[model samples]
Target: MEGDCLSCMKYLMFIFNFFIFLGGSFLLGVGVWVLLDPLGFREIVAANPLLFTGVYVVLASGGVLFLLGFLGCCGAIRENRLLLLSFFMLILFIFLAELAAAILAFLFREHLTREYFSRELKRHYQGHNSSDVFTSTWNAVMTTFDCCGVNGPEDFEDSLFRLLSPRTMVPEACCQSNGFPGDVSVEQCVSGSATFRRNKGCYSATVDYFETLLFSAGALLIVVLTIEIFAMVFAMCLFRGIQ
Candidate 1:
């Protein structure tokens, strides 16, 4: 009975680690795709320091998961105490790191307010004509989301964009039209026309976008963490049962 239970535990460990291996491969593929995408993804990520850092984090996480999965599989199959212990230690370290990160995020949540982002936008945002990365990124964001400044057109009142281009109330990306081309004249957009200017702010649109992304990522994270816990438990059990 004891031998049968040990065999069962060993197989369970293998199955769980195999799943983790597949998940890690998927994450690694995604990270590589984003990094090497021929489209505008690389450019967009490069434009933002935070986004660039996130890409690297994704890559590192994928690599670590891949390594952990391999270690778990090998340790279980060979019933190697050293490998099992290493796997447990690594998982514990990652679990503790995640906890620390979560605590820090919660502590700093209040600082990530709209007012803070608005101030940053006002300080660094150049006009539409500027070819800088920040300007281009904002143009792309505004165009993609069909929204204007952080809090709408009013936010640009004292912006550098307004100071630089006094005649233009908002970027051309903020304009909306009913025509085929859908490109309303900038004059109409700036003439206080309600239909021409998009009333929605980029802040809310960005929040919604990130919320959707985070929901998906959070689900995946929970699954991965659960698998890790199971892997750790099975690894320790098998390690102890081994002769």
Candidate 2:
């Protein structure tokens, strides 16, 4: 009976590890998506150090999870107590680290506000004519998100507008309507009229973008953590049974 029970746990662990392997793959996919997402990923990366670090951290963790899941599968199938214990220890460390990160995020939640995004935007806002990568990225964000400046049109008042030769009110990207391709006149967009400018500010759009990312990542983390906890429990059971 004891031998039969141990045999049952061995297979149970194998099944559990398979699910863990799938979870690891999901993490890997999300990491790659964030790294390559064309819309606003680059903008976000250049804007905030904390978010930049978080992206790479998630990517690295996904890689680790992939390897650990393989290790777990092998350990469970072969009844290797050493491998199972090692897997358990690594997962425990990761779980604790995630918990710590969560606490830090909650404690510093105030820092993740629109003001923070505005500050970042203003800090990096180069002239519209600049060919720098950051400038281009910012333009792409503003154009794609259909937003202007950080707080509103006023945010750019201090940046590129100040550097303008004749002091245009807004950039072509911030215009409410795209001017005709053949028309080279700046009178339509740079006319210093409220009708030509975008009504929404980049600050709110930027906040929503990050909020969506956080929600997706948080959901994924919860799923992965739950899997890890279950995998740990099953591995422990198998290890004990084998011994």
Candidate 3:
């Protein structure tokens, strides 16, 4: 009976680690993709450092999970107490960190809303067609998402616009005439008519994009964390049995 239980625990540990390895690979791939995303979807979290930090955290955690999962598999198969103890400690640390992060995310979510994004974006907008990096990034955002200013096209017409480009109310990308695949200039698009510009703002759209990403990431983490906990439990059981 004792031997049978040990065998079952070993099998459970191996199976759990296999799933952990797969989950870690998925997270690692997503983190790398987010870091290299051409569209710059992470810009939505420009105001909050946590969201940006979360990306690196995901990558690091995935790496740890991958390595530790292998270690766990070996420990279970070989019935090594030291390896099992090490796996338990590492996974415990990760579990605590993830729980803390989740709590903080929940607490601060109210401050990271679309209104906050709009306000931050307002501070960065240099004008309709300025040659600054922020301006270019905003232009890319508008073009990619088919949006206008923060709240609308009129959001561009302000003290900022007066200081930069007095005549232009919106960027060329806001206009439907702006050619995305070609070398069309902002001058040509804005010169036509107001009817060509998109009426919707990018603030909501950008927020929505990041919100979806956050939700998916949170769900995945929950699953991975649950797996980690179960693996730890079974590992401890096996360690005790071996002793």
Candidate 4:
């Protein structure tokens, strides 16, 4: 009975190490392809402008933490304090980062509104069965935000308008080509252009925030994932040494 129990324990440990390493690897691949890829960024932002831009940071960060937790769990099972502690430390750090961000958002009352972004999604459609796409688009937006940083709903609305607004398409000369008629002060031209530019500015801010948030998420994922991989390797070494 004692011999059988020991063998069972050994196998369980091996399984833990093996499975976590696999999970870690899977997470790393996702972090790279889905969250960090530049092309992926454009698709996500264009589809669900509001949802993806805000919380994308957390998705990628937590994913890395999940990988770390797996490593630690496996390391503990193998009785490797060094490897186990390394993962634990990573979790502790991630927890703190999440906590700080959450507190700040709450304290500042920085709520993200999805209305504007969803509107952009609606516009993307060919007008054939576009309603059903909202939730999916919204979820994608949320996922993007999770992996990146989003300012709020307003920010995305502004960004979309900036990049896609057609105000620039309408040249000022078209409005003024008739000449101010009476006295066309220089202020008129400046003010007229500025008025049109305001609309573009809104979109520019929105798009800029979204892009920045996505890039930041990608950056963090790269670093955290690297650590997660190292933890897995360490766990495997311990598992092998156990034999």
Candidate 5:
């Protein structure tokens, strides 16, 4: 009965590791895709330092998971104690790292407020249709969120774009309309007319979008951590049963 249980656990470990390998491959592929940026998605993420760091984090995680999965599979199949031990250590390290990251994120949460974002926006935003990455990214954000600047049209008052284009109060992206350039005329939008202007700032909409993504990611993190625990347990059990 013990032998049978050990055999079953070995197979379970193999299957679970195989799935983890596949997941790692998928993440690696996504990281590569973003890095290569054939679809222009990289431009959006590259605009933010945090988002850019997240890409590398994904790549690192995928590589670690790939290595772990390989070690687990080999250790289970060959009944190699060294490989199993390595896998266990790696998982534990990752678990601890995740806990630390979570703690740090919680502690720094206060720094990520709207005022902070608005200050950053004020420092960097050039204008609508500017060729710079920061301007382009902000344009994309304003357009996607249907919000203007970091805190409405006034935020652009002192912008380089406004300085250059004295007549235009806000970008065309700030127009409230059914289409890309907006159904309203540029003159109307620039005139600060309520019917044509997007009065709200991008902060609220940006927060909502990121909060949803973070919630989903947090849930996924929990699931991954749980799986790591099970994997460590199985690896340890199998290592002991090997003799």
Candidate 6:
């Protein structure tokens, strides 16, 4: 038992290192792929404009944090003197980059916001080109780039792609049976006239804002946790590489 326990402890030490690197890898992948919000289509832009923009910013920052944390963790597991030293320097640069971006976002957010609002209003009135309901889903796209301190980046493109992504919806039968607001409506004696508001694959301000808020919060969590996971994974990989 004593020998087994000792062996287990030794194994745990290595396992933990592997876990560290695993976490780092996972976070890195998620940071790159699982991102949404400013890049997603929740119709938050035309719906609540500024409110939705804030949510998108928060969600994006969360992903950035995960990426940072994972990088740091990967450096932690490095025993190679050169690798360790390089990571030390890299982490500092990453931190500075983040700080600079934060400052820029803070300063530019207000100036750009007024124009941003106007554009959103326009989109709202126009209703997102007949294809999208609540028509202004694209306004938040600009808002996101402004907040991110970039004019035209892949981030902007990704945001648009997310909008065109397929959406999940309840079946017409289910919606009608449960009296959900869907395409089909029934006219019953007690209910009189039931109308399912015509939604052209777009949500109104209330729906968009609420949905974006929830998704934004979810994205934040995923990013933050993913970073920690990356850190753990990176640590493990580093240790194993040396062994």
Which candidate comes out best when scored by TM-score?
3
Candidate 1 lDDT: 0.78
Cα lDDT listed for each candidate: 0.78, 0.75, 0.78, 0.45, 0.77, 0.39
TM-score of each: 0.83, 0.83, 0.85, 0.32, 0.78, 0.35
Which segments of candidate 2 are over 4 A away from where they belong? 131-134, 158-166, 176-186, 206-213
Sliding window of 10 residues with minimal summed lDDT for model 3: 183-192
Query: At residue 243, what lDDT does model 1 achieve?
Result: 77
Provide the lDDT at 218 for model 5.
76
lDDT of 4 at 7: 49
lDDT of 4: 0.45
lDDT of 4 by residue, 80-186 (tens): 65665576466556656756765665664423444443454334422112244543443343333332113222233333323444232221221222345543432
lDDT of 1 by residue, 1-243 (tens): 999999999999999988788778877886898788544455445545666776777777778888888888888888899988899899778767766756765786655677866786787788767888887877777877778887888888888877877877777767775555645466688756667789899879877766876687778777888888898899889989987
Model 5 worst lDDT window (10 residues): 177-186
After superposition of all CA atoms, the RMSD between model 4 and the true structure is 14.4
Model 3 gets an lDDT of 0.78
What would the per-residue lDDT of candidate 5 be over residues 98-140, giving only the tens digit for each residue? 7787787688666566676666666777766578788887787
Tens digit of per-residue lDDT, candidate 6, span 37-91? 3344443333554445554454455455445444443444334535534544544
Off by over 4 Å in 5: 29-44, 129-131, 157-168, 176-184, 207-212
* RMSD list, candidates in order: 3.2, 2.9, 3.1, 14.4, 3.6, 13.5
Error of 1 at 41 (Å): 6.6
lDDT of 2 at 26: 77
lDDT of candidate 3 over 119-184, digit per residue (tens): 656667775557776667677778778888778776765536445666666667688763456635
